[model samples]
Target: MTGRLKDKVVLITGAASGIGEHTARLFASEGALVVISDINAAAGERLARELGMHFIAADVSKEEEVERAVSSTVGWHGRLDCMVNNAGMVGVVGSILETGAEDWRRTLSVLLDSVFFGIKHAGRQMRELGGGGVILSLSSLAGLVGGVGPQVYSVAKAGVIALTRGAASELSAYGIRVNAVAPGLVMTPLVEEVYGGHDAALRGGAAKSPLGSAAMPQEIAASLCYLASDEARHVSAHTLVIDSGVSAAGAGAAPQFHHQPADFLGRLPEQYQ
Candidate 1:
C-alpha cells in the first residue's frame, strides 16, 4: 500500500505458498515487479496470474534450475533488485537414530543447498549488472538455539544464517545486501498438517512465545518487504528474528502448553515448547 518497493524487480523462490506466497503478495502491493518461482507450477502460475506477475517453475534443490530462474527473471524484467531464497521443506522428521542418511541429505538438499544456489546465482547477476541488490533467505528460530526443530532442519536453517553473513561480506562491496529471517512457530499449511490442524497448532505454538502469540506468514512477509526495500540499505548480514520474543526468552522461560481435551489434536514435540 505504501509502494515502498516501487518499481523494484524481485524474484522469490517457493512463492507458491506460505511465507513466500505472502511475501510475493506484499512485494507486489508495495509496487514491486514480482517473479515467483516454485516447483508447484500450477499454483505458482495461478498466483502469478492473480498478481499480474511472472512465474518460473524451479526445483531449487538443483543449481541449474536456480540459475535459470534468476536468468529468466532478469530476461523478463531487464533487471533484478532482490532475490528471496525462500524455497524449503521440513524433511526427515524423525529422531537421530530413526533418521536415515539419504533422508538427511535429501532434506539438506532442499532446505540448505537451494539457498546457497540462490545466493550464488543472484549475487553473480547483481554484480554483473552493476550490482546493488538485496538477498533474503528464510531461516528459523530452530536455527538460532537448540531443541526447537528436528535435527536436519535446524542444521540447514542455521546454515542459512551463516551463509547470509558470509555472502554479505563478499557482496557488500558491490552494494548487494544479504540477510535471513528467522521466525518461530508460524501457522503455515505444513505446520497445520503437522499439528493435526490449525487450532491445535496455533494453541501449542503460540503458548511458547513470550508475546503469547505466534507468527503468521503475512507478518514474515512484511518483514521481508522492509529488508528488501531501501529502508534496509545499511542493514546487511542480519538474521531478523520475528518470533514474538520466543528466541529472546530463556530456555526455561518459555511457557508450557496447557492442552485441553478438545485441544489436544496431536502432541507436539517437547523440543518445540
Candidate 2:
C-alpha cells in the first residue's frame, strides 16, 4: 500500500533534531521525498543520509537562504509539495524590561521572521509550479494563552498564527493550504533548556498537564504529518493546538502575577506596596 505522503516533495527546516527531526523521519516513513534543511549541516546531512533523503543548509530567518532552499528542492525533485516551517528558537527568555532591541529582534528573527520567509518563498514556488501545496508552521500554546512562555517567545509564536491565517486566506485561491500546530508542554531538549534541566522540565510539564504526562515530540510530529498530508486537503488558515487539555483547564507554567509580580515587574507594583 502507498503511504499518506507517497512521492510528495517535502522540505522541513531545522530537520536536524527535536520536532523537525521526528517529522523528517515520519515523512520519510510515509514515502515523502524529504529535504532536511538546517544550520546544523553535520546533523542535517547525517539525517538525510539515514533516511535516504536530501539535505540543504539554510538559515530560515534570511529571505535569500529560504529562497535558495526552496529552489534547491525544486531543482532536485522538480516541485515542492510541502514546506514545513519548523525552524525556531526560544527567543528572549528574560522579562520584557530586560530585553534589548537587538535581543528582541534576534528572537523574532528566529521565531517569526523565519516563518514569514518560509511562507513567501514556498508560496511562490507552489504558485510557480501551478499551485497546490501544504505549508505547515510550528506555533505554540503560549501564543494563545498568557504566562506559559517567555515574553518574546509567546509574541513571536502568536505572530506565526496570524501569518498562517493571513497567508492561508491569500493562498487558498491557488489550492495551497497554510496551517499551524501549537503544542503546549512538550519534553524536548529545547524545553529542557528553558526549564533549566531535562528532568525538571519533564516534571514541571507533567505537573501542569491534566493528563499527568507531558507531550512527547512524536505526538506533535504526528499532527504536523496529518496537516502535510492529503487528509487535510481542505484544512487551512487553522491553528490546531495540541496540549493534552492543559490550555482548557486554565493551567499554565508561569508564575501568577498577583503572587509573583516580581516576575513581571521585577518588583512589587507601587500600588501593591
Candidate 3:
C-alpha cells in the first residue's frame, strides 16, 4: 500500500544520527525519496543504503556544501517537497564566561548558520516547485529559554526560532511553510555521550523528566512526519515543543533552591530552619 508521503521527495541534514537518522528512516518508510546529508560519510551512506535513500556528504554550515546537497537532491528526485534542517552541534557544557570564542563560533556555525544555509538553499528549491513545501527545523528548549550548560548552544537555538518566524512570515507568500520542533532531553546517542556514555546518566535524564522519562528518537521522528505531511499545511511559523513539559515548568534536571518559610520558628530562633 502507498503511504502519506508516497512520491514525495524529502531532504534532511545531519541524517547520519540522532533525530535526523530516525527522521530519514521514517520518511523513506513512508515512501518518500529521501536525501540524507551529513558530514559523516560512513553513517550517511550506511543509512542511505539501509533505507534505499540517497546520501550526500555535505556540511550544512558551508554554503557550497549546502547548495550542492540541495541541488543534488532536486536534480536526482526531480522535485523537492520537504527540507529538515537537523544538523547541529552540542557545545561544551560551560557557562557563558567560560565559553571561548572559537567554541562559540563553532556552536553558532553548527546550530545556527547550518539552519540558515538550509533555509536559504532549500527555500530556493522549494520556490521552484511553486511552494507547497515544508521547512522543518530542529530547535530546542534552549531556543525559548536559558538554563544549564552551553551558552552558545542556547543562543544559537534562539536564533533558530527567530529564523523560523522570519522565514515563515515571508515564505508564506510563496506558499512554503516554515516551522520548528523544540525537543526536550531525548535519549539519543548525543545525550548518551553527554551523560558520559553511562546508563546511569541516561536514567538520570529520564528520572529528571516531569513525565518520568525522556522521549525516544522515534517519538521526535513521528512529530517530524506530522509536520511534513499535508495535515500541517496550515501550520506555519510555529514551534511544536516535544519537551515533555520541561520548558513549561522548568522541571527536568534543573536545580530547585527555595528556602522554606521560617514564620513559625521566627519567634523561636533566628538561626532555625
Candidate 4:
C-alpha cells in the first residue's frame, strides 16, 4: 500500500485525537502531505510535529476557520487531494426529552454543520484543483439504524450520510468522489469520555458483537485510505459500514451471553454482600 496516497495533499479535521489523529498519522505514513486541523492547538501541533505534517488550528463549524484551513493547505502544498471531515461532538447521552435544546444545537453545529461547511469549502478547492479529489466523511452506523444513538447525534450523522450521497452525485461530474464511513464502537478517546472513563462500554460493545472485539482506529484508517486512493475510483455516493457485525444481528440475540452450566455460577453484588 506504499504510495497509495503518495504526494497527495489532505486536510483532516479533529486531527488532535482519536480516529482523526490516527488517520492523520496513517495518511502521512502512507506518503500524503497531511494538513491536520483541530480546535486543540497543543494536541494538533504535537501531532503535526510528530508526523512531519502541517497543523492548522481551526474550528470546522465556522466558515472563516474552515476556509483558512483549506486555503492554507492549497497555499502550502499547491493542491488539495482529499478532505476528511472528522471533527464532531457526540450529543449528551440521554433520551430525547432529557436532552436540552442547547445541547442539541451544539451537537448539530459541530457534527452536522461542520460537515456541511467542509464540503462547501473543500469542494470548491477540489474544483479549483481541476477535480481529481476525494472527500470522505466520518459518519457512524448510528445513522443507519433506528434507535441506535442519542437523538441529536444520530440525526446529525444521518444528515452526513445524505450529504455524502448528494455531494457525490453532483460532484462526480467534476471528478470529485464523495463517500462516508459508518463506524461502530471504536475505542477512541471520545468514546472513552462518553462511556464514563472506563473501558467497560467498549468491552461490552465488543463482547456483544459477533466478532467479539472493537476495531482499532488504524483499521478504520485503512478503509479511509482505500476510499481516498485510486483503488476505489468507482466508489462514490456510498457509505461503507465498518461495524463488527453489530448491524447484522437481531436485538433479541443472546448467543454471546450463553455460558456452560459449569461456568455459570454467579456471585452476589458487593452491595448485597
User: How many pairs of residues collide in each model?
Assistant: 0, 0, 0, 0
* Per-prediction TM-score: 0.91, 0.91, 0.89, 0.89
Pairs of residues clashing in candidate 1: none
Backbone clashes in model 3, listed as residue pairs: none
Q: What do the candidate models score in CA lDDT, each in turn?
A: 0.86, 0.86, 0.80, 0.82
Q: Is candidate 3 or 4 superior in lDDT?
A: 4
Residues 1-273, model 3: lDDT tens digits: 248788789999999998999999888888888999988888899999998889998866678999899999999988889999998766544545555576567567778998999999889888877856999999988677666335666788889999999999989888999999998777787777657775865796777677887688899999999999988889999999887777777753332111222122123112111
Candidate 4 lDDT, tens digit per residue, 1-273? 488899989999998988998898889888899999998888999999998889999976677899899999999999999999998766445556555676567668788988988998889998877957999999997788765566676889999999999999989988999999999878787666545664776786677568988778888988999999999999999999988887888433332222212111122112111
Candidate 2 clashes between residue pairs 3 or more apart in a chain or in different chains: none
Regions of model 2 farther than 4 Å from truth: 256-273
lDDT of 3 at 254: 34
RMSD of each: 5.6, 6.3, 10.7, 8.5
- Superposed Cα RMSD, model 4: 8.5
Could you tell me which 10 consecutive residues in candidate 1 have the lowest summed lDDT? Answer: 256-265
